[model samples]
Structure formats: structure tokens, C-alpha cells
Target: MRITWWGHATTTIEANGTRLLTDPVLTSRIAHLRRRRGPAPLPEAGECDAVLISHMHADHLHLTSLPLVAPDAALVVPRGAAKLIHADSGPAFSDRCIEVAPGNQVRIGSLDITTVTANHDGRRLPWSGHSGPAVGYRVEGAPSVWFAGDTDLYDELAAEAGPVDLALVPVGGWGPSLGPGHLDAVRAAEAVRRVRAKIAVPVHFGTFWPIGMDWVKPELFLPPGDKFKAAVDPEVRVELLEPGESIEVLA
Candidate 1:
């Protein structure tokens, strides 16, 4: 299996001849955030059989970058989140969306993508009124992959996902404080242990930063990848890739 980290939470999972892209923020900037480390995702990043969106956060559920997916690629998003996008992206755009909550599963060619619960709130906006749980994905194929979209550690996490070969974990965010429902390097390391994954690749860190706050808690930006790697158990292999880099794993 080949996995490419496109900076932040965006990653391309290639296995069993099927490709999946997650939470693609393909542009340099989103809202008040700017890409600080990696280059913009190459065109090949958008070429996927399906697109996995973890939640409704602008960075994870980037509306503008949604069109970058292959024409026929499935857009898998949290339930209720699709409606928020269709209103702005046109009704026709909704045709490609496959909304899911935890425990739901969808087949994409040679892989079976199942949604697992994430402990984050996925509401589109403060007053938007849409509601649904955030989610992660478990891709069952040659090299089983667990894409832990955006979530803090939960008790049933490992039991629900029935993990396989590789795990893509979110170790940090763009801002200084991670707040309530997020994982820092220490917690992310614990999560890797919970999932019992053989290989772990840290994502959602060392990439984007707030527009003018580059000097504030700068360690929260790029050092997370390094920290997560150091925190993980030595028994489990950690493949920490820079944004835009790919690693091939034999599962």
C-alpha cells in the first residue's frame, strides 16, 4: 500500500488498485489559515476512487477543493454535512456525495470503506442547525487502513474499526490550543496503541498555520510530527512523512 501525506489531514491512500483521498484542502489558504510547510497537492492527489471527509470543519470539508476530486470519485462525508455543501455547490453536486455516520459502510471498487465515530462536532456553522457526528474511516483491502479523520481517543475506537495494516492518525492542528475534542502528540501516541496498528503515519500537523500567528506557539505547527513519532511505542513502526511525500508499505 502507498500512502501520501498532502499536508494537514489530507492524505491519499492507495491499496488493492483503489485510491482514496481524505479531507483534501488542496489550496494554500483556507479561511484565516495558510500553508506553512508543504507545496499544494499535486493534481494526482485528487485522482481517487473516493474522497473521505472527516467532518464539516472548513479545513476537513473544504468546499472549494471538493471539485478537485475525479469526476466519478465518491464524496464520503459526515451525515447532514452534504446538504450544507449542496446548497452552495448546486444540487447536481450532491449526486456524488455519500453521507455516512459511524457504523455505515460503502463499497468502492476493491475496497470497503466503513465510517467510524469521531469525538468531534461536525456542525457546518455556529447557527447552521445541521447536526451529525464527526467520523473516521476504516478501509478494508490488501493493506487495511484506518483513517482517523479528526477525533479524540474514545473507548470503543479500536473495537469498532477492526484495524488492519496501516493507521493514519491526526496528531495536531493549525491553531495553538487543540481544545476539547482533539488529539495532541501524547494522546495520538496512546491512540495508536489502542488501535493496535502495525504501522502509523502522523497527519494533520506541521503544515498549515494561522494567517498572522506564525510566532505564537510555533511548536504546535511543525513539531507535532516529530513529537508524535517520539511518543509512539518503539514496537510499532512509525512512518513519518513530510507533506507531499509518499511511503510504500508491505502489509
Candidate 2:
């Protein structure tokens, strides 16, 4: 399977001749924050057979980037998301949105995707005018991959996700300190160990940040991913990709 990190929580996974996009936040600027790094590859949502909405957070479920995918692509979103997507972004999303909850499965062409529970608040910021459930995905095909969308360490995660070839785990956020229901590099490394994935990719770091706060402590934005990789068990290989970079893994 081929995996590409597109900054923040967004990723593109290709397996079984099908492309799956996860939490696509392709815009250069989202609300008050401007992407400090170069934008992700042009036309960010490219030829995806399905798109996974991990949660309703703007950084994860940016509606602006949704249209980049093919209109026919199936959208695998959390339960109660359809209404919220329509209410927040309008009815244009109704055509292909498929609402799913933990343990639910959806098939897109040759791939079978199963939703998994996430230990995080799923509600979209009421002020943002969007809301939806939070969840993760376990995709099975030529190469099974687990995308643990923005979640903290939870006891049931190892048993729920099972073994997979690759795991995409979030290690940081766009803030100086992580709050309840979020994972720091140490916690994310522990989560990777629990899942027992053959290969792990650290994401959700080194992306957008609040303007004018760069002086407070810039290391917070750049080092968490590498720190996580260094702390994790060496048995599992780790790949840290810059935005727009791709990695191929054989399980």
C-alpha cells in the first residue's frame, strides 16, 4: 500500500487499486491560521474512491477541501454527520455521504472499511456551525491500514483495531499544550505499540499555527513527531513524511 501525508490529519492511502483519502484539509488557509509550510500538492483530493471523515473538527473535516474529490466518490463519515454536513456546508454533500459508526463497515469497490471507536469529543465547535461524530477507520484490502483519527490512548483500541500493516496515528495538535482527549507524542507512541502495526506513520504535527504566536516556542510545532518516533519500540518501523511526500509499504 502507498500512503501520503498531506499535513495535519489528512492522508491519502492507495491499495487494491483504489485510493482512499482521510480527513482531507487541503486549503492553504483555514479561518485565522495560514499554512506556514507550502500547500499540499495541487488538487489535493485526487482520484479517491472513498473519503474518510475522522471527525468534525475543522482541521480534520474541512468542507472547503471536500469538493476536490470526484463527485462520485463515496464519503465515509461518522453517524449524524450527513445532517451536519448539509446544515454547515449545504446539500451539495448529500449525494455521496455514507454515515457510519463504530464497528460499521462500508465497501468501496474492492476495499472493505470498518469504523472504530475514538476516545475524543466528536462534536464540531458550535461556533463553527458544523457538527459530527468522531471515529477512526480500519481499511482491509491488499494491505490493511488503520487510521486512528485524532484520539487519545484508550484501553479498547488494541482489541478494536486488530492487527494492520500500517497505522496512521496523530501525535500532536496545533496548540502549545494538549488538552483532555488529545494525544501527545508519548501517548501516541504507546498507542502504536498497543495496535502492533508493522509500520507506523506519525502525523497531525508541523502544520498550521495561530498567527503571531511563533515566538512563544516554535519547537512545539516541529519536534513532536520525531520525538514520538524515537521513543516508540524499535521493532515497528516509523516513517515521518513531510507534507506531499509518499511512502510505500509491503506487509
Candidate 3:
């Protein structure tokens, strides 16, 4: 299996001749923030086979970047997302969208994808009037991969995800202050231990940040991945890849 980190929560997992992209944010930057380090170049959406949206957050389920995926490509989004995607912007929005709830599974090419529950706010904002449940995904192929989306530690996570060869976890966010429904470095490391994946990749950090906050500690933007690696058990190999870098793991 080959995993490529595009940036933030975005990643492309290739296995069995299929490419699955998770939470794509193709823009060079988002809101007032910019990608300061990692991945001089970002991958285009057309390069993927299917797109998985973990939630309705602007960064995760970006409407502007949705067009990058091929029109024929299947779009797996959180349950009730179709109502939100179509009602707000007419039927033109997400024409290929497929709604999925936890435990729901879909077969695309050689991959079998199963949606898993996520513990995060899944609202489309009042202006959009589109709301849905947040979710994670367990993609099974030659080597199974789990994308945890944006979620805090939950007791049922391991059972829900089953056994995955690679686990992609969120360790930080855009800001230093982490609210509920998010995971810090320590918590993420603990999650890695619980899931017991053969390989772990830390994401959701060192991407976007609020403008004019340069005075704040810069390390806050860049240290979560390393911290999680240090805290997690050494037996579980951690691959800290720069954005846009790809790593191949044999099953």
C-alpha cells in the first residue's frame, strides 16, 4: 500500500490499483492561514479514484476543491450530507455524492470502504442549512487503511475500526487552543496504542493558522507529529512524512 500526505487531513492511499483520497484540501492555503512547510507541490483531485469526506467542516469537505475530483469518481460523504449538499446549492453541488452512515459499506473497484462513527461536531453552518453526522472510514484492500478524520479518543474506536494495517490520526488543529472533539499529541498516541495498527501517520497539524498570530510560539504549529511519535510505543512504527511525500508499505 502507498500513502501520500497531501496536507492537513488530506491523504491518498493507493492499493490494489485503486486510489482513495481522504478529506481533500487542495488549496495552497485556507482562510487567513498558509502552508508554511512541507510539500512544495500538492496533488490534484483528478488523480484520485474516490473521495472520502469525514465531516462537513469547510476544510475537510471543501466545496471549492470538490470539482478537482473527476466527475465520474464516486464521492463518499457523511450520512445526510446529500440533503445538505444539494439543498443549499441546488443539485449542481456534489453530483456524484453518496451518503454513508457508520457501518455502511461500499465497494469501489478492488476496495471495500466502511464508514465508522466519529465524535465531532458535524454541522454545515446556519447559512448553508446542511447538516450531517461526522464519520471516519476503514478502507479495506490488499492492505487495510483507517482514516480517523477529525475525532477525539473514544472507547469504541478500536472495535469500530477493526484491525487496520495503517492508521491515519489527527494530532493537532489550526490553533493552539484545542476545543472538545479534538485530539492532542498524547491522546493521539494513546489512540495509536489502542488501535494497534502496524503503521501510524500523524496529520491535521502544521498547515493553516490564524493571521497576525506570529507572536505566538511557532513550535505549536509544527511539533505534534514528533511529540506523538515520541510518546507512542516504539514497537509500532510511525512514519512522519512531509506533506506531499508518499510512503509505501508492504502487507
Regions of model 2 farther than 4 Å from truth: 128-132
Give the per-residue lDDT of model 1 (tens digit) for 58-160: 8898888988778888888888877887887976568888999999999987889888989887777665776678999999877788999889988898898
Cα deviation of 83, candidate 3, in Å: 2.8
lDDT of each: 0.87, 0.84, 0.83
Backbone clash tally for model 2? 0
Task: Rank candidates by lDDT, best first.
Answer: 1, 2, 3
Per-candidate Cα RMSD to the true structure, in Å, reads 1.1, 1.5, 1.8
lDDT per residue, candidate 2, 90-145, as tens digits? 77776579999998999987788999989988988857555556899999865688
Weakest lDDT window of 10 consecutive positions for candidate 1 = 123-132
- Over 4 Å off, model 1: none
Residue 224: error of model 1 in Å?
1.2
Better of 2 and 3 by TM-score: 2
The top-ranked prediction according to TM-score is: 1
Error of 2 at 78 (Å): 0.7
Model 3 / residue 207 / CA error / Å = 1.2
